[model samples]
Target: MLALIGEALLAYVVIVAVQILINDGLFGLAKVFVQRIRDLPGVDLLIGAVIKREADSFLRQIDSKRSPTVEMSIKIPEKGISHDDLREEMKQLKGEEVNLDDGQIFAYVYTAQNEHYKAMEDAYLAFTDTTGTGTEKGDTDHETLVREFLRAFMHENALNPIVFPALRRFETETAAMAADMLNGDANVVGSLTSGGTESILMAIKTYRDRARSLFPHIKSPEMVAPITIHPAFEKAAHYFDVKIVHVPLDSDFKPNLDKYRQAITSRTILLLASAPQYCHGIVDPIEEIGNIAREKGLPFHVDACFGGFMLPWVEKLGYTVPKFDFRVEAVTSISADIHKYGYGLKGASLILYRNSDIRKYQLFAYSEWPGGLFGSPGMTGSRPGGNIAASWAALRAIGQDGYLRMARRLMEATLALRDGIERIPGLAILGKPEMTAFAIASTDSHLDILALADAMEEKGWRMERQQFPNSLHCTILPHHVTLVDKLLNDLRESAENVRGKKAKGGTAAIYGMVGKIPDKAIVDTFIKQFLSDVYTCKT
Candidate 1:
């Protein structure tokens, strides 16, 4: 046991070493080893070919194929095109895009109806110049309050409260409203962030800073979390030089509380739980986890980014949602995304702490620069007022009653989809989902899930494909209710079509190639190259 723990500690030191080395912004240095592994004789290229087919076929499945002449020769125009021409070019760029309006794709975009998007779009246009002027000429209309926020380039720097009063109010009131939903009183304090990932990053950073302030000599700080916890935490661990200790989930898809509690060491600074984790949508036993955190005197962060806006209504609508909020005394902080279920515009999330003191760590008020006093909250310097104002507008627009109605409709849809998937002969849900998002695995040996996913895609319904358990993921949005009948029909057809038949291509091929790779480090190598390809442009 001591040896295993020693290994974990040694690995953590390496992580911290890399963090120190990369401090001067040698970000690519991080991917150095992963890329080198890919270049090994029996790495991605050779190993992938041995797994299935020729070099070209395996390369295409991995998306490792380089650009051809046409794409490589593409060049920037000397002069900008007209607005109409630009819009046309962008449309052409999509080639044949999936119809998101018709509920053709799941996972990313969350939409209910056309009017919902229309209202947000109109709200966005209302404040086209979201950071135009710091001084506010207030508009009496409520939505113009959104525009009032949008019209000014507002900085919520407490150092210059005189310049932007409305922005600060927007941030405070937005946090207050979210706090109210989470059963918080006046004591709860938080800041608006770019998105769920930023909210998570801020929470991790705050606790790390807090630990540093409290125990100045503690160099090796670690966080305890479930394996199902989002990748954002790993990113946080990498960025903040903190060691994250992850434990596996049990059969019920919750973290083994015994193992979780046992994993806590002297260096442990924080505990983490997720409200309906992104993968299987199974929420951890946060109340239990928080209790342990309190016993240990550690900061407990509940990542409710996916469920924060949605779960309150889910519980209200008579679903068996667990307690994971400010209501739970030991839940010291929570990260929630307003855009996801709050139906706010994209790029808005909130990280809430129990009080101002705890939240202060996330706030950096530095007089380091020559320009008077420059202090900004979170990672971003000049924050977008539009995200803040739009969030406020969205919460107001969809009041409690309105949200309840939306929640009811989505739950019903989710239930229908879940039932349909279960009824299908070969497919089975990974676990009993407490929320709408879930993954469906193939129980029948003959059925290939990735092949079925390909079939679904062919039927114009693109669902998120998942790994480890090897399942097809689905998150039933309100728009999904309208497409359910078609979805079920296509799903059934796909199951029948792929039963006992091997997948020729699509997701099956990709996973097959990936599953063959013995080391995940090699997989990471491919991913790094893939991400590099994503940003690579020619000419």
Candidate 2:
């Protein structure tokens, strides 16, 4: 009887344990589904309101002592204002309410000088009211000149390069130019993408498709990259259903090549090395990683979106930037943005492959469409030709010598800022930055990096806060050279002001919370809700 009772108790305990485990798993799944449901259009507003309220509350606390407070006025005007009146109002707001011209902001305005600003404004005005038909027969009118140029240069559709001979030529020429800049030969080929994100997406998608084709038995395609690599790769993995293997970086923010190599397997398709990554602005060990990729016969991608234009110029300016381009034997591809450092309009970026054969994989084509066969080289179907014209114009106008001069000035300013930050007692620079972008963090026990950022914001500085290390980040531009000392002074004062203040709220707190959340699904749902809210316009 005693033995039977003991056996019954054990069985009951095992059953209960299994039931508990099952229940917990179901609960987690249900939570994810609920969060996703909340992210839908109608429901997302509630989440957004809550988040905005939280952020606003935090901002108020941070700016309580400041005279001109950071506040949000969400209500629309009762009556529509004239364009001229609105422009005047905006000017007044800037002069009276908020003035970023005090030289505290970073990166957003590359040319803050009056002459450059006026030139850009004029360029914008010249094209603002123009409209055009297709490229042919449109060059005579101002509205159609850009359109005609684009039509003459490339096809309306990027996918059908054969049908659009001009697009093929333009793409080929652009790729060649990029490859030459990177020290590659005729074997190099690439595609023009919308931006850095699309370029990354194409690379990831190509690798994923190629891996599946080659290794039919491997269900999951994996990629290895440093944690500091741009978040776009993570987004790529999410979209394409590939597993990501993120390797940690060294103290200097460079990737550990050995660990990266160890992470690689037969199922691995690509390895990523950023030429001065976004967070701390430290270049990875690209040569070593490229060699590894060659030995393993894997495709290596150098993400030079930030450094691509600048690094080449910096090299010409006599800076010892590491080799991170097609010149490296294993670097099969690269993504470089013209919008950021290239001084072009937004929405222009390029992705280059080692050769046409490899780039062919990025193309999407279908003959069964009712619209007489459909194909696209990159992501977009009908890209605006105006953007292309502007990008081409900016590149030609800047020229090589112009870029080199800008690079020299920017580097000097960056060094000066670095020196000033180092002089501060409680602040420490993150790593040996290889470019103009760098991050600063607090070494003092009581200092909160986010609080410091908030304090700076109160001073009309729009600095970005970075995670992984909790630091204040900046991306310097050519125009920032004149205001570097002013920025340094403000930063020093802000640091001192927020020395003992706890990080309360704002982007810093939100990101800090996001980092702590173990389940990424919930965080993703929250972010989706936030984005949906941003797009939601009340009637």
Candidate 3:
């Protein structure tokens, strides 16, 4: 009798434990069992093998001749080469790179005309030294003298406004000009950043700090943004310890308003919208998002990094563009890249705030530093004044008239390209792109866009490939304006060549596997390893 009772008690205990686990949810129990499976012998080895295989596959696609192990001796340069020799070496190196001047590349290089680019180059070369030393060639013309005058403050450090007041004026005046173009009020203010990523990082940092000071009850802060937004925001979230909650896009490739409203929580610190998202180039409903932000009492940020410089002019040219700037009352901040459509040299962007109070959080100051009291308005301590000077020069050189003209031509080319793509039976534009940038996708399953991209690449056309509904990205710059017909012809021929086939090798195969991978973590691991391999020197 005693043995039977003991057995009964043991059964009862097991039953109770099962009931408790069921109440807690079967997901936890499944996870516990799954973890056990992972802990089994050879599971870890299998995972590692899978990751390594994926990585090696990508590396082979990129560099078919790369060795598994590189045993190389380091060579240190003890003496400099002669200037003529250096020039020859540079020419040889440039020969290995794709020629952007031919307008075969879809994106990456944005230039107006040879003269405009030369002016920017001249300006940059002039301000390269502190002693006012310029290029070897002396200025003998009006344009050269103007460039010389612009580069006068090139060596001056923008960190100290008091030491070099001219940089301060250049920055302030540039900010003011941008603000006015965006319909900002007297209270609008901003600072120049290295690029769009830095601008986004500063915005995230500012909002995070602001939340810490004001909303003490919130333990974790979150940013609500559309998934179509740029990856820089993800990087910013990772850097600033802020959580990002992504909202999906609607059928129209715009942010779904209902989902966006539902994603908001008490921890949401900022709301983000893009003037024209990079993937599809469809502008999100910024005005509606601004309303939601206002209703929720959250700060709104418009990422106009790609479209900011072009949209205003596009609107002026009678193109119907949605208001994405300060015209929306809830828009508390904006990030615009002067390097893109603004025709500035690379590595220059602006982070603008609705008012000074909001911007104060972006500033950092240290009084106990050993060197001295230090304060910086932006991220870097020592910034390259040459970029800033060239950006300012670009903005000034390409006044409203110049920008408007480019906008008109770009828009026309974009439409022409879109119509041509649509005319192709198995191809279509991704969405109603409001600007020069857009995407192309295959309508028929048998026609692999990746394979099509590869075919076009073989024909001396470089098209950027995008995943998640596979597509080819195209950005119509001023240089690409005249090559619309050529691009369409190549695209048509490439589509026909790739029809009813799949990418089995090369870069296309890599992208195909990436898009089809169900477990994103595995893809992420492969990407990390691929990047490491790319940057790893043989020596």
Query: How close is every model to the real structure, measured as TM-score?
Result: 0.72, 0.70, 0.73
Candidate 3 per-residue lDDT, tens place, 293-363, comes to 99999999999998888898899899889999999999999999887887665577999999988998999
CA lDDT scores, all candidates in order: 0.75, 0.72, 0.77
Would you give me the overall lDDT of model 3? 0.77
Better of 1 and 2 by lDDT: 1
Candidate 2 per-residue lDDT over residues 1-539, each given as its tens digit? 99999999999867765675587776755665677789688787687679779968976775463442212211112232233442333233223322235666432223455887667656654564222211112323322333334323221344444333334434555556666777877787777778899998998888887777667787878889999989998898999998889998888888877799899998788888899898988889899998899898988989999888788878777888898887788998899987777655556788888886678789888987786866777777766443554444344444565566677888998989999999988898998988989999888988888898888888888878887788988888754767888898898888888888887877877887898899989998999999999999978
lDDT of 3 at 270: 91
What is the per-residue lDDT of model 1 for residues 365-477, given as tens digits with 9 covering 90 to 100? 76757856666678887665556755655565456776677778878878888899899999988877888788899999999888888888887887788888888888766
When sorted by TM-score, best at the front, the candidate numbers are 3, 1, 2
Model 3: residue 119 alpha-carbon error in angstroms: 20
All candidates: CA RMSD (Å) = 20.9, 21.6, 21.0
Native-to-model Cα distance after best TM-score fit, residue 186 in candidate 3, in Å: 1.5
Highest lDDT: give the candidate number.
3
Off by over 4 Å in 2: 1-169
- Candidate with the greatest TM-score versus the true structure: 3
